[model samples]
Target: MKFQKPDFNPRIMPPKLKVLTLEVEKFDNNFAGVCYKNGRRYVIDGAIPGDVVKAAAVESFNNITYCGLLAVVKPSEKRVRPKCRYYDSCGGCDFMAVGLKDELAFKTDYVRRRLFPFGTEVRDAATEKGFRNKITLAFEKTNGKLNVGFIDDKTKKVTDVSECLMHEAVFSDLVKALRFWIEDNDVSIYVPRFGTGTLRFAVARYLDGQLLLTVVGTKSLPSTEDLYKKLKKRFPKVGLFENVNAEKTNEAVVGDVKHLYGEKFIESEMLGIKFRLGPDSFFQTNAAVCGKIYEDALEIVRGKNPSVVYDMYSGIGITSALFSRVAKKVVSVEIVKKAARAQKELLSENGISNVEVIEGDTEEALKNVAVEKGGVFFVDPPRRGLSGATEEILRFEPKAVLYLSCNPDTLVKDVEKFVAAGYKAVSATPYNMFRATTHVEIMVLLEKIENDE
Candidate 1:
């Protein structure tokens, strides 16, 4: 069912919500719960398996529905108090009520269950911990003062979250300090009304105990120079500073960037390869787990060193570089022009001459590359799964295809399609990248059937 429908009424609950007892079966991901309500299959929220919770109807759209906890009819043995104070209202995290260790286990199990339908088990999956590296908080004004927090679920109303459990303690402190800094300077918060103002967003990255600040606004901020200078003065170890003016109505930071402090970008090492990350480039939030994920992807390309490797949806080219080292040639396909350009620059700077950046849709770009008789194809599509065109390209058949997905439901659906297209599922590896949340990332390796034409 499409989640594009209008918001559910707050007063009207879903029908049969009260009578149905939810036995949380498994977690789909953050914001979704898999449970059997009233002896029928149902996806519930605010309840997990082994927790006998009295769930009250919250909302229902199409076939999917949401419920709120009315009483703990029963509690899971592994359940624990959420660490953040914004657990109830703040929408940043959906698994705050789950224990860290148990949450990881549940995520792993979610992947395993999804693969069960295909008769594949993820055996070598790792439970990566302490891997959260980045987070984006909404910037809004509350009580006539600038406040940094996440918006309530299904609403633009800001929810004040002083403490976010996903981030390290220092990062949270930076958010607080930033709010004070903006308020003290009397800078106007960029309101979305006709899109005219400065101070739209403040995204900070914590690396090596140093923060890289990127301030975004609808219009250029006049005080950006002074603000950067003051922030650097207060925090001596600030690594990089940038100001981005996104005049467009979208949330993405797409504008002329001014390097207020430090170099144009900062360098971070991942999977033994160097990556250049600017404020605009996309990188995995959990860096350490990403290293393992990259390693696993490399393992799929082991021994059978192909003449060419196609890294589809190559985000910032991290995976592209990793595969380039082993393959005779690697071609990275990405739609974002800026990120593709950054990948090109990084490849050139690192003296990695074997890789080429193709800026376009993966499905279209892959058709242009002349893959040798035995070449590998790696596709990491978005949560929505592969594009229809990309799916058709996969049907054309490659030696081996490595499918990396952050959502199991979509992964299962896509894998089923691959299996139907004469691809054999050789292996699947599940990883718990997001702890204390239902999110799980998986790597699936499939090979073309010998009988396939």
Candidate 2:
């Protein structure tokens, strides 16, 4: 999800400057505060709305200045004591310093600024603690000692947190276990420059009560059997696995996964429907906010009651499962080979027979599927919205199109194209999925506009 940057003028390039006192006006997407001084915008990290902060300029570009917050001369009323001890140091959360109420309000206004003239409304989430169901920790070596933690977005430094209140309560204990296991076993930490190490990353996912963990390394560890025993002792129901990512790149993405212990697919639920999720399954970390999006889509389905529903870019088929209940038949077009089968299995697990899974690109699959001219489209695309699929989807002449987007800019870009293709904008509602963060999940509705031909 894209955050608002410093509102800067492109033609006016500002030069580097020294330290100064600035009253922060508002927050950008990164939870940094923005303030204008002498017709220039300064973005100070860790500053908040209504704050009087002392800042030193790090760099300046085009009218926008990046600064570091030295001290808070006067704290804003919006500021509150952060719950996480590592909130000041850890790079996990974006808005931990601000109160939850104010954070939600800021996010609501942010959606308005992005999706103007669509009558947008933000469904503020009440999620604060235990909101996330997933966590990824980076493994680094500092001075020949194993360090496991989250990597800071700016400095690229990794710092471990004693407690992570985002996921299940057991995560805090789980991290300690990882530290002891990696350090005691003398595990080799992956170094990108030298390209010789084992431990690269640790990924944990929790659903309801079941937890799944995958310890990633450049190559399989000989001591993995010991790690599996430790996990089974702590989290009995935990699915233990080791992922091999032998690629020379520094990215933590897994290449091959091997299940070591426990359940392969954890049974998870969303809106009362149970679904099975594997280790590599893509799901929204914030479950409560995802429910809000699904509920709103259900409401739209109730209003339209179309005969056929086309779920374009359906990942894992969760939305398709929901659509199958309301529509007579649901056609899902998914591109990834593995994802296509996963969608079919997900629907089958829930006893859903109405959804026909088409394993191919949206444009090609649409040609073979028989659709009612009155069918509606449901799309929750990746950041690079629609790309070339928007025109193909509009060709169906669906009665309505409900789009869920994480990137506001792409959402607007795709919506504009739909409007040009004889669709009228109905409403755009943004959902705050992540707590204490500026990230937004938006859902926009468009209806076909009929005219005298």
lDDT leader: 2
TM-score of each: 0.85, 0.91
* Model 2 TM-score relative to the real fold: 0.91
Cα lDDT computed for each candidate against the true fold = 0.70, 0.79
Q: Over the full model, what C-alpha lDDT does candidate 2 score relative to the true structure? A: 0.79
Model 2: lDDT of residue 393: 87
Candidate 1 residue 204 Cα shift, in angstroms, is: 2.1
lDDT of 1 by residue, 184-268 (tens): 7787776675565577777766655556777776655656666666657656556444556665554545655566765456677
Model 1 ranges off by over 4 Å: 1-43, 59-66, 154-156, 190-198, 234-256, 389-396
RMSD of 1: 3.8
Candidate 1's TM-score: 0.85
Residue-wise lDDT of candidate 2 within 1-453, one digit each (tens)?
322334322123255547789999987655579999899988987789899998777667788888777779999998888888777667678688877778778877776666666544545433424378888888777787666778866556687666776666777778887887877798888877788877888888888777888888877876877776777777767888888888876566656678887778778788766777787778888877777778789889778998899998888888899998899999998987778898888887789999988899887788787657888899988899988888788778899999988898798889888888888777777676777767777788889989989
